[model samples]
Target: MATAEKDGKIYCRFSRPKSLASMKVEEEDDPSGPTEITIDLSSGKVIFIAVGKTYNGGNDLAEHVEAPVLSSGKVDFSQFKVARGTTMTLLTQLHGVAMVLAWMLFVSFATVEGRYFREGFGSKMVCGLKLWFQMHRVVTMIAGILTAAGFILIFVKVKGLSKNAQAHTYIGIIVMAATCGQIFLGLIRPDATAGWRPKFNWAHRLLGKATHILAAADLILAFRLPMVSPEMRHFGTTVVAVWISVQVVWEVTFEVNKYLQSKSPKVDSIPGKEETKIEEKVIWKDPNGRLQLILCILFVLTIVSCSVATLCAILIF
Candidate 1:
């Protein structure tokens, strides 16, 4: 058999013994239309025929459906629904869950705790480390793990970089690289008294904030990719918008509060003299620490809700 094209239409030719041949004309422009076939016989006669539209593998070309798997004595995949796309799979769903939890929830909370909640926790120690530092370290560790795991899952599913999802894929690679670098830097952080400690702190904070921003951007790009369903894309976009808005509000409110706290006057007294009002720079202590706690709690709740909503959008479709 051989194929040819005439007038922008494809024709498949089949040759048989005894001087016989056949040609099938396919609907190139509109596969939903009827097909035509011609047969040439040894007696110098031709037969022309028409048939209804034939199967064109449209669904297969458009999307891929994962096969059900049986493992560990039973099949468990039936309980979960799989979305229809080349990039939508059980692994991709899990990847989305991991990323949302990592970047949007854990990392966001960790950044807030380290940045603004230090005064709230004071010098309180947990396991010989400052309370804020401990919480930040632990939460960031979880986020790092999730970020790495999600990267691995998607890489395994795709088997290589994706050409169609260039924006998401490249941004994800950069985010993953930054995350790994941040983790390494955190693990080898210098003591406060070290001359280079300030430099390390700046590098750490900047890398972390940049990674978080890139990860968020990658998520938004993922939603815009062709493989994602329209419903999932819309839902994910809304969730990201709300999460970003809350983060911005939380940061601005705390910064303003910190500024006001720094400028407030404090009462001072001598051993044998009257009390005096002194203007001092109180950078480390926040008189409105309670407000920080309240706002932090609300911000955390919003992150969790957004993460869960985004996960459901990826998994349920």
Candidate 2:
């Protein structure tokens, strides 16, 4: 078996074996995909076959009916029998694709922006970070699947990791709790958005921050990083610092740019119908909309700041 570290921590075990029909028959099909892509431990050939459904066929690569949701482009027979060690590579693919899917679903569901654009990247991809909000529900559901799978695999299969298990377990629990809370918020968000938007937004943002923190913590705790005579806990701290710094820079840059853009003279000259204002006795007419925007910004900041804090707290602990 040939093993290669593809990314920083995620390693891939490769082999080249012919069709292993017996292994396929014996093993339970992986629920990740329609077909079960199995590896022959003796060699490393991945037979892109699938086991049948309850009332259907068996594990024959050729006889599989379901098409791969994530295609490997044109088939490359030469690059086969690859097994990834960590969940990073697979989760990256799943999360990336799922984000794209979530964007599409958002556009389909309630995209006033999607309708106006005819050319260029559709509102799905090109739209700003608010796109994240619109697609939150679908994206959460997809990310939920990947996160759950990863938790199960890591908890069950991680054999030798002992020092950081407690921290890792804590982070996993936070993410799971956050994910459930986020999903719940989204389900009631229709009514919630109308009345309790502020609270809902806070809960969602807090969970978002929790997810980022857990992810950063997990990255550091990987078995094979900073093997430079460093303690395992240092790795966790380093990941937290790096993740927070990067996120802060990305978010701040985005906001500064957006603020500058919105302030530009050209933006205000759009041919809209009327000005949003009212000369009442003392009350502002559009308080609700203003409140909504304020809550949105508040949540955004909450998530960013909390993510930064989660890592800092772990380090201090």
Candidate 3:
């Protein structure tokens, strides 16, 4: 032992001789793991070294220190182990962080998926949409926090991640990029462009579709791709998809029935009956203009925010 004994405690420190293998991950599968080193705390000596098969497959890349050569340079073989092992602490920390983050993003996606549209268009649904939108923001904030944190954590402990995690990262990166693209489309203004640019609405809507597609892909990668092991990704995806379908059904039904009911204002049909000014007697009872304005504002805000957030995440991380 290289460590010295303190007043009431015993400390053990050890160091290894120097070598080239300790500088990088020697694993056959994952080549990005950390290099091994010998640390002698009491003696205050740290040296680079390499060994046999490690838990991460790192050791297989290098040979252990054999007995010293015939001359003055003798190698130390006494401390060599046939199998190498990984540090449990680092692996645990990395997995814990990534898992937490992935789960958070999943939760956010789930929250906003099934409830917004159907409940957003009704007289009573005004409050419902408000509350749902509030929760949506909450979930979005949580996901952003988790994703940023997880990205850092995974980058640090990358070697320990299974292939699935690696795949998940790639898909996540794409989703992030799509999200940014979606946001970018919103910054356009027709007047500012001197008519040289494409329509902002079209670009924005297209990117939104892209973002939605990428989100689905992200869920798949995060769950089934490589090393990702989230238990709820599939279930959440199914639920969201089903909910979206139902919302579509409801929208179609509402629109078809509404169109049929609105067949009147039939003043247009009686064109030959002398152009009478019926407009003066028409009394509008529904004060829907104000509500329409509010809904429009909400839509615009949601688009701007979701786009900005997705873009920011992709750019920063």
Which one is best on TM-score? Answer: 1
- Tens digits of per-residue lDDT, candidate 2, 1-317, equal 56566557655455545554332222235443344444344443323322234422544423223322233323445555433232232443343233222222221122211221111122445354335344544545665665665555555554435553556456556666676666677677755347768877677666665665565554444322322123334544554555456545645654453344332222233377555433324222332345434534554454445444433332222
Task: Pick the winner on TM-score between candidates 1 and 2.
Answer: 1
Estimate candidate 3's alpha-carbon lDDT, on a 0 to 1 scale: 0.43
Query: Residue 172 of model 1: what lDDT?
Result: 91
Model 2's lDDT to the true fold? 0.43
Q: In model 1, what are the clashing residue pairs, if there are any?
A: none
TM match of model 1 to true structure: 0.68
Q: Mark the 10 consecutive residues where model 1 has the least summed lDDT.
A: 59-68
TM-score of each: 0.68, 0.38, 0.36
The CA lDDT of each predicted structure is 0.74, 0.43, 0.43
Task: Tell me the TM-score of model 3.
Answer: 0.36
- Write the candidate numbers in order of decreasing TM-score: 1, 2, 3
Residue 124 alpha-carbon offset, candidate 3, angstroms? 16
lDDT per residue for candidate 3 within 1-317, as digits (tens), equals 48788998766666555432334444435556556564333332223232344444433344332211121122344454332222123433444344334332333243333232324434443344455545544655465455556555656665544554455577666655654454354344355556655566466546554555555455444334322123233443444354334434543544453344332432334756765434433233223445434543554444344334332322222
Superposed on all Cα atoms, the candidates' RMSDs to the truth, in angstroms, are: 12.9, 17.5, 13.9
Most lDDT-accurate candidate: 1
